[model samples]
Target: MEAFVSTEDEPDEVVDAELVPGDSHLPVIRHQTPLVPDADPDAWLPPEAAQDVADGIAQATRDAYELHFTQFAKWCAMEGRRHLPAAGDSVTAYVSHLTRTPREKTGKPYSPSTLDSVIAAIRTVHRDRKLPVPETKGARQVVTGYRERLALAKDAASRPNKASPAKRDVLRRAVRTLDRTTLAGRRDAALMLLGHACATRGGELVHLDIESLTPDDEGRGFTARLYRRKLKKWQDVGVFYDEDEELCPVRATYDLIDALELEGHTTGPLFLRMDRWGYLAPPMQREGKTIGDPTGRMTAEAASDIVERAMARAGQPGRWRSHSLRRGFVNSAREAGVDIVDIGRHGGWADGSKALIGYIEEADAFSDSNPLAQINEAERRKRGAHDQH
Candidate 1:
C-alpha cells in the first residue's frame, strides 16, 4: 500500500514500512489491529490525525475535502503519477502540472488564481494530516505570489488571449429570443431571471426548492429564501412589484407553475419540470439530498445540464452555460447603471462579498475582454504602417 524512498543512511534497504497500512503517523500500531491503509487517503494521517480533522470540519466539509482529494487522485492517475498520495513531492508536482499544463480540449491553461485553488486543495489535505510540508505557494503569500507570477508568464508565452465580445453577444442574443409562451419558456425565463437576475451560481439555482421559496398569493409577487451554499447559510431576497406593475423575482416561474397546473404552499418547489410532452408529474428525488417527498426536484448539476440542453434547444451555442446567465445578469444590470450594492443584495450576496466583486468590474477596468479598447490600438498599427510606407 506504500511506495517508499531510501535515504543514504539507510543503505537502500529502508522499507516502506511506515507508509504501509497508511497509518504512517501511527505509533507502532499492532498487526493484529484491523488496519486498512488503502481506505485511508495518503496514509500520512494516523487515525488520530484524521480524528483531529474530523473535529475541525463539519461532516459535509469533510465529504467535500474527500471529494476533491479523490479528484486530485484521479487526475494524478491520468497523468501516470499514482504515487502522489504517498509523497509531498507528488502533491507539489501535481499543483505545478495544473498551472503549467493546458487543458487538452480547450487548450486553455489555468489562471493564476485557479492554479492557487489546486495548490490549496493539496495543502488542505496535508494540513489535515498534520504532516511536515515545505512552505508552498498555496499556504504562503510569497509562494502564492510567485506561483501566480509564473502562471502569468506562461499565459503570456501562450499569447495575450483576447476574449471576444462577440462570444458574449451571441449568448445574450439567444437568451433574449427564447420562447416565452409555453411552459418551457416560463422555465427558461425563470432560469434566465436567476442567471440574469444575479448572475447566480448554477449550483445555487439548481438546489433551490419549494420549502425555501415564498410567493405572495395576492398576485402582487413572491419572495425567495435561498440557503446559499457558498455562504453556508440562508439569505432572503425578494423580487415583487406593486399591484399594477410586474416585477417579481420568479414571475416567469410563477407563470410556468400556473401553465403547468401546479399549486402548493410558498414552501413548494418554485420550478417543477415537466416531461418532454409537458407532463406535470414530479420526478423522484435523490433521498437525503432533500426532505419528505422525492419528486419534481432539481439539482445544481442537473440544472447545469438542463441549461445546456435548453440552450441547444433554443439554438444557442453549447458554451452558453448556466454561468453565462449569471454573468449576463451582472453585465446587463451594470450596463443599466444599477449600483453595485443594490446588485449584490438582489443577487443574495453577503456583506463584504469582495471575492465576487469582479462581476461588477467593468471590462475596461482590466481591458482583458474589452474589444473596443483593443480595437483602437489597431489604428496605431495602421498609422505606423502608413508612415513607414
Candidate 2:
C-alpha cells in the first residue's frame, strides 16, 4: 500500500499542524495515490469510471470526508503512525484521543455523532481507494463507551441538542414583529411561513424556485413542488390560507412575489440574499451569462440565522434552529389531533421512522395518556368531591 506523504520539505519531521480557527499552518498531505501501487498505468481506473465513482456521493459528504480524513492524516503524521491503510489498534487509539481532546475554542470534546462521522470518513476514503476498510469494531466500541459515559453524566452538554420548536404561537409572534414594507422583512416572512407550511429543511427552503410553486384551483392555497433529497423524488406540499391573514402562508407568498416582481425578478430562486441597504443580490453569472447558481440563493446557514433572529425579536428564548420549522409542524399537528402517519408523510419522513416516532413520543409526554396527568386529574376530582360534601 502507498504511504502518506507530507507536502513539507522535511518528510520525517511533522510541521505546524494544529487544527484551530484562523490557523492556516495545517500541513497538507498528498494522498491521491492508489492504495496499492501498480507498475502498469493500465491498472488504474478509466477517467470516466473514476468520475462516476466520485459522483456517487453527494458533494457535501465528499467535502466532509476530505476534511475528516485530512485531520486524521495530520494526527497520524504527528504521532509518527501510518494513516492510509491504518492498523486497527491505531484506529482505536485515535478514537480515544478524540474523545479526550477538547477543542481550543469551545473547550468541549467532540460529540458522539462527530466521532462516528470521523470513523465513517476514514472508511469512505479507504473504500474510494479500493482498499479494504480497516477494522472498526474496536473504534465503534470506543464510541459506544463514550456515549454511555455521556449518558451517565446527565448534564446539559450530554443531552441531545434539540432545536426549539417554532410552534404556531411562536411563529405568529415572530412574523407580527417583522416590518412588512421592507424587502428583508417580506422575504423573511415568506421564508418562515412557507418554510413552516411545507415543513422544509433549510436546504429545501433555499433550493425552491418560482417555478416550483403552483396555485390551487380554488385559490385557497399553493402547492409547492419540492425535490426530496432523501427520498430522491419530487413531492408536492400544500400551503393553505390561514384564518389569520397576518400568519397566512399563502398571503405571505403572494406579498413576497409581488415585491420581487416589482424588482424585475419573477423567476429563479424563491428566496434571495439581500444587502443591508435592501438591494437584492443579482443572479450569479458564468462567462457573461446568468446561470442557476448557489451564489444567488440564500444559504442554509443564513436561513437558520434568520429563524434565530426572528425568535430573538419575538422574545421567545431557547435554541431555535432551521429545523425548528419542521419539528414545530410535527408537534403542532400532533397537538391538533393529526394522525402520526399523516404528519410523517407531510414532513417527508420515511414510514415508521424512529425519528418521527421520537418526536411523537415527546409531544405526548404530558398528554392525557400520561400517568402524571391522570394522577393530577384524579387529585383535582377528589378535592372537588370533598369540598361539595
Candidate 3:
C-alpha cells in the first residue's frame, strides 16, 4: 500500500511527499509543493494532506468523524483554499463559512453545536498532522474565536418553526395508509410503525432479527431488542395495540405472521422480499436453490428503497425518510408527556436532553390538557385559603 501526501509551500507552486510505496521496505522522498503567488492560503491544510491525515485515522474514528471532515473538505474545495497558512485567522475564516453558509434545504445556517463538531474534526486533523494551523493568537484562543462566531450563528438558527399537532397527525395518517400486503409494503409498514410505535431508527431496523425479537408467551405482544450503534447502546422495546386500532405496528406484524401461515418460525428473517410470482421469499434462499444468492442478509439500502417506494404509492406529501420514523415517534412520545428520560429509553438514546433537544414538542399534546393538572391547581388554591384562615 503506497501513500502520497501533497501540500502547498509557496504561491503558485506545490509540494509532495512519497511514503509507504508498493514495496513495504523502500525509502521515499519528501518533496516541497510550492503555491502560486496569486493563490490564496487555504484555511488550514491542503486537500490531499487533509485526506491523507484523515485516512491514517482508525476505522472506528473515521466512521465517527468522516461526515464532518468530508463536509469541511467540500467547503474548502468550493472556496479554493488549497493550502494551510501558519495563521489561525485562516481557520477562523473557514469556521465563519460553516457558521454563515445557509442550508439549501432548510434555509438556515449551522448551529454552534454542529459547527463545533465540524471545526473540531478539522482541528483534530491539523493537530494530529502537526500542521501550523494558526493565524490569530494561540491555538486555543483561535478555537475560542471560532466558537464565538459559531455561537453567533447558533443564535441566528435558534428561532423555532411552529407547526400544528393536527399537521403531525395528518402525517401519521399518511404513514398508516401504506399498503401492508407486499413484502416491501409489510416491511415498510412494520418499520414505520416500529419507528412511530416503538421509536426505532433505520439502522436499528436493518439490524432486526428473530433472535433480537421475541414474544411473551402463547399470544401476547412482541419485544424488540435494539442494539444502538451511535452510543453502542441497547434497548428492550415492548409493543402492543388494541384489536381495533388501525396503523398499529404490532397488529401489522401479527397480521404478517398469520398471512404467511407461519405457525412457528424461530429463525430466518423477520422481513423478506416478495418474488415476481407474488410469493414471500426468505432474505436468503437455500444455497442449492435455482436463483438465490449464498448470502442470506438484506442490505440496509434495499430496506430504505422499499420504504421510499411505499411512501410514493401511499400519496404521502412530506418526505418519508428513515429517521422520520424515529423522529415521529419521539415527537409523539414527548407530546404524550412521557418523561424525557423514558423517552430516551424508548428511543434507545443515551441522553434524553440531547435527543429531545433536536425534537420540537408537537402542539397537539396540549389539546387534551391533563385534568389532574386542573384538579391539582384547585387543591392548591383551597390549601392556600386554609392557610389564610
Candidate 4:
C-alpha cells in the first residue's frame, strides 16, 4: 500500500481507508477530523487536484483575488478578527470601514463596485479552502445603504470617474502628430484608429493575432475576428477606410502590417513592442519555432499609455484612457443617427448594458432632447419670415 499525502500541513490521523479500481494498492484515507466540518466526504479532492482547480481561473483574475484577499487579511489582523471563517457581524463591520475609509492616493472612499469586489474576494477565498462561505447579507445591505447615502449627499466624489470620449476631431488631430515614416509612428496610428473603429477594449487590442485580420473583398476595409474574453467567443469587427487618407484606419493598419512583414514576421502578434530607437522586438521562439510570449506582446497598460500620450501630444485636454476610444465610438455612432442596437452589437456590448445606454443617453441629451435648441430654431424661422415681408 502506498502512503497518501495530505493536502494540508496538519498531521493526517487516518482512521480508515478504501481502495478504488485504478489504484487498488493505494488507499484513499479518511481522517478522523476533516478540514471542512460537515462537508460531504465524497466531495473532497486529492492533493494532486489543487493545481487543476487553480488553472480554471484566469491569471489576471487570480492576481486581483490575491491582492483583495491580502488586504482583507491585513485589516482582520488589525481588528483582531479571524478572516478565514469571518463572522457575519465582522464582515458587515468591514464593509462599513471600507465605505468610510478614504484611499491614501485618491483621498476618497472606495467606489461601491470596488467594495462589492472586496466582499466577493473574501467569499471566494473561503470557498477555495473548502470552508463555508460567510453570509454577506449584512455586507450587501451596508453597500446598498452607502449608495443611498451617496445619492442623498450628491457628492461629486461619489460619481464614477468615467474616461472621456475621444471624438472624431480629437482622433484626427492626434493621428496627425505622429510621423508616418517611422515604424513606431505607424503602429501607434494603427492602434488608435483600429481601436476606435472596432471599439476594442485594451485587452482585446493587445491580444489580437495577425492571422485574425482579413482584408475586405472589395478592398474597402478589413474584418478582424477579435476574441472577446468576457463573452468567451470570437466576434468580427469591420473597419473601413476614411475619406481622409491621414485618418484612415484601413490605411494605417496596412502600413503597420507592411512594416512588420519587412521584419520577417508574417503572423503571431498583431502588435509588437518597439524601443526608443524605433527597432522592433523580435518574436519569441521556442525549439526554433515562434511562440506567444509576453515579452513580444503589448500589454493593456502600454496600450492605455499610447492613447494618453497621443492625446497629450495633440493638445487634447481632459482624462483620456484606452476606454476613451470605445466610448468615443458609441457616442459618435449615436450622434450619426445609428440605431442603438446596431451600435451596441458593433461594440460587443451585451444587450441592455447600462454603460452602453449611458453613452447613448449622453448623445441624445445634446441633440434629440435639447429644449434650448428647439426654441432657438423656432425663433430663427419667425425672424426670417418677418425680414422677408
Candidate 5:
C-alpha cells in the first residue's frame, strides 16, 4: 500500500511513500526518497543530510520538539501567520506575545528557561527541514532583552518568580502535615523525604527501579544507583534513614512497599501511580508476565505536582518545585558546614561543579563566613582588647 508523506516547501503536496513495519501499531517510515525542494520535487535528499536529520535527535527530544512546535503552530494559527519555516519577524512577534500573555492551563507567563526551550524547539524543526532558523540574532536579542527587562520588573515589584528551595524547617513542616495513615499519604511522605535525602531530580526519582537500590551494611539505609539524565551517566547515591521513624525515607519506602504488596518484585519501577479513588494502582498482567506485576511509573511532572500540593497543604508560601528538594538539600548541607566537595558528590554532581560552587557561595554569603562579617568580628575583638588595656 502507498502512503502520503508530507513534504516541506509544498504545503498542499504529498508524495507516495512505502511504509515500514514498526514495533508498535504505528508503521516506521524509510522515506524512500529525499525531501527535495519544490523546484526539484523528484530529486532525492542527500544521504548525509537525511542521516543527520534521523540521528541528530533522540526520541524524547523529538517528542518535546513536536510538542513545542504544535504550541507555536497554534499561536501562529491564531495570529494568522505562517509557522513552517517561521519568519524571524514572526518569531520576535511570538516572543512578544509569550511575554505579554499568560498560559491558559497555569494562568502564568512562561519562564525564561521555558522560553529558551521553546526557541530550541523551533530551531530543531527548522534544522530538520533544512530551512534557515527563524530565530536570527536580532530575534534572539529581542527575546533575551525582554527576558532581562521582565526580570528587572519582577525584582522591582518584590515578586521575583523563582522556586523557593525547601529548607530544613520547610521539609519538617511538610512532613508533619502528611497523613501517613493512608497508602497514598505514606507514599507521598516517603517521596518527599527520599527526594530530599538523595537530592535526586524529579525525573530520576520517577525512573528509579527496585534493582537500583541496595541495602546498607546496617540495613538502616539503602544505596541508590541513580541515573543522571543531564550527565548521561549513573551515580551511586546514599540515602540514610533519619533517627525519627516518622520522617525516615527508608522506613517510609519500606512501609509503602509492604502496603502495595510489592514483595519479590525487584525489577519494576520503585514508584507507582495512584488512582483517582486514592488507591494505589493495581499491578497489571502482561502476556508473558506474572499476575499483579507492577510496571507503571510516575512522571517528573507528577513529582512536581506532588511537591506543589504538599507545600500548599503545609502552609508554605511562594512557588515550590521538585528541584526545590534538591536545592534545599544542597543549601541545608552547606549551612551545616558540610564541605562543598562532599555535598557535590552526594548530589551526583561532577567534581568542582560550578553550579555546586554557586550554591555554596550563595549559602556562605549570609553566614559568618562572609569576609565583611569576619572583618567586623576581628575589629570588635581589637576594640575590646584596647578598652581592656
Candidate 6:
C-alpha cells in the first residue's frame, strides 16, 4: 500500500512508499519502517523519526484519531464513497450521518464535539497522506449549521447522557460492596479511593509506578507523582487519607501493596492486572507480563473497566463513567465550598478553562443550595410569616 514519509526538506511531498507494519496494537504509521532508502540519502529521516511522530501527538490522541479514521473508512466502504483525500461534500455527509444516526449499542447520536473530533481525524489523516483536505465550500457551512442546530435543540433529545457526580455519599456506599478480604477487592477499593482522592484521569492512574508515590513526612497521607500528558510534565499531587481507614485512599493503597507483596520495592507498576483465577501475581510471575518494552503500566481501558465493574457492583449502573472519579472529587470539593482555583489545581484543569466551568456548573446544579431549593425555601418562609401575622 502507498504511504507518505516525512523528509527534512519539502515535508509536504508525497512519495510512493511501502507501508511497514508496527505493533499490531497501534496504527501502521506509528511503526518505523525503511522508506525505500531514497535516492538522496539526506532525504532520509533520522532514526528517531517514528518517535518524533509519536511524540508530536499524545498517545491517547493518536488512538482517538486512529479510531475516528477507521470509523470513517468503514462508513465510506459501506456507502461506496471515497475516503482518502475525501471531498468536502463527503466529509460533511459523514458528519451529518453521525449527528442523525443513533449508535447501535447506545441508541444515541454523536455529540457536536464528537463530530468535530471526527473532522480533526480526517484532517490529520489527509495531512499524513500529503493530500489537501477540502476544508472549504459547503463543508464548513454544514459543520456550522450542525452546531447551530445542536445549540437550538439543547433539550435532552440532542444532549448526550448526563454524567452524575460520584459524591461522597455514593462512594462511601460503593466502598461497602468490595470484598476487602480478596486481593481484587483490595486493589479495586484502593483504585477507586485513589482515583477520587487524587482526581486522576484513567491514563494517569494506570501509569502510576511504585516509585511515583512519596510518603508525607507528616504521615497524614502520600503524594502521588503523575505525568500530566497535556502539560508534558510530571506533577506531584497529595493524596490525603480520610479519618475512616475504610474510605482512606492512602491506607487502601498500602493495603493493596501489602497484598501484592511489593512492599519496599520502589519499582514496577503500582497496580497490576489480576490473573484469571482472581489472584495477584507474585513478583516472579510479573516478569513474564512485561515481554516488550513494558512500562508495566496498565491500559487506560482496563482502568475504565475496573471503574465500570466496581460502580456496577455498587449498584450504580449507567450512572457513571471513568470520569466520575475525577468529576466526583471536583464536585465534592466544590460542594464543600472549596475554591474553584483549588479545585482546578487539584484536578489538573487549566485556569479559567471552559471545561472547569462546566464541572463547577454541574456541581452547583445538584447542590443543596441550588436555585430551585432556595426559591422553595423562601416561599415557604414567607407563607409561614404571613400566617403568623
Give candidate 2's TM-score.
0.83
TM-score of every candidate relative to the true structure: 0.58, 0.83, 0.57, 0.80, 0.75, 0.75
Q: Give per-residue CA lDDT, model 4, range 1-389, as digits (tens).
A: 00111134655434556975696777887766666467577876776687677767666777777777777777877887777678878788998998889987889778887788888877887777766789999999999889878878996545777888988888999888999888899889999989898998889998888888998999889899898766667899888898878778889988999988998878888888877777776465799988655548887777888999999999998888888899888877877899999998888988898988898888778785578889988899999999999
Per TM-score, the best of the predicted structures is 2
lDDT of each: 0.56, 0.83, 0.58, 0.82, 0.75, 0.75
The clash numbers for all candidates, in the given order, read 10, 0, 18, 0, 1, 0
Tens digit per residue, CA lDDT, model 2, 96-169: 99989986569987788888888998887777665678999999999999988987886455567789888888
Clashing pairs in 5: 34-45
Model 4 residue 313 CA deviation (Å) reads 1.5
- For lDDT, the strongest prediction is 2
lDDT for model 5, please: 0.75
Residue-level lDDT of model 5, residues 1-389, one tens digit each, is: 00111234655534458987756865777666756446556545777776665554554666766777788877876787778778988877777778777767887766666666678878777766656788556656766776787677873322335467887789888878878887778778878788888888888888887778899998769988898876778988878878767667788887777766643444577777777666554665579775433566877777788889999988999778888888888888988899888898888888888877876787788788999999999999999999999
Candidate 4 regions exceeding 4 Å error are: 1-38, 45-58, 105-107, 148-156, 282-295, 369-389
Which TM-score value belongs to model 4? 0.80
Superposed model 3: Cα runs more than 4 Å off: 1-87, 97-114, 127-172, 241-245, 254-319, 334-337, 357-389
> Could you tell me the TM-score of candidate 6?
0.75
What's the CA error at residue 124 for candidate 3, in Å?
3.2
TM-score of model 1 relative to the true fold? 0.58
Tens-place lDDT digits, model 1, residues 236-353? 7665552311223366666666665543424445555566776644554465464423556555555566567656665764455566666566565666567778877777677668
Which should have the higher lDDT, number 1 or number 4?
4
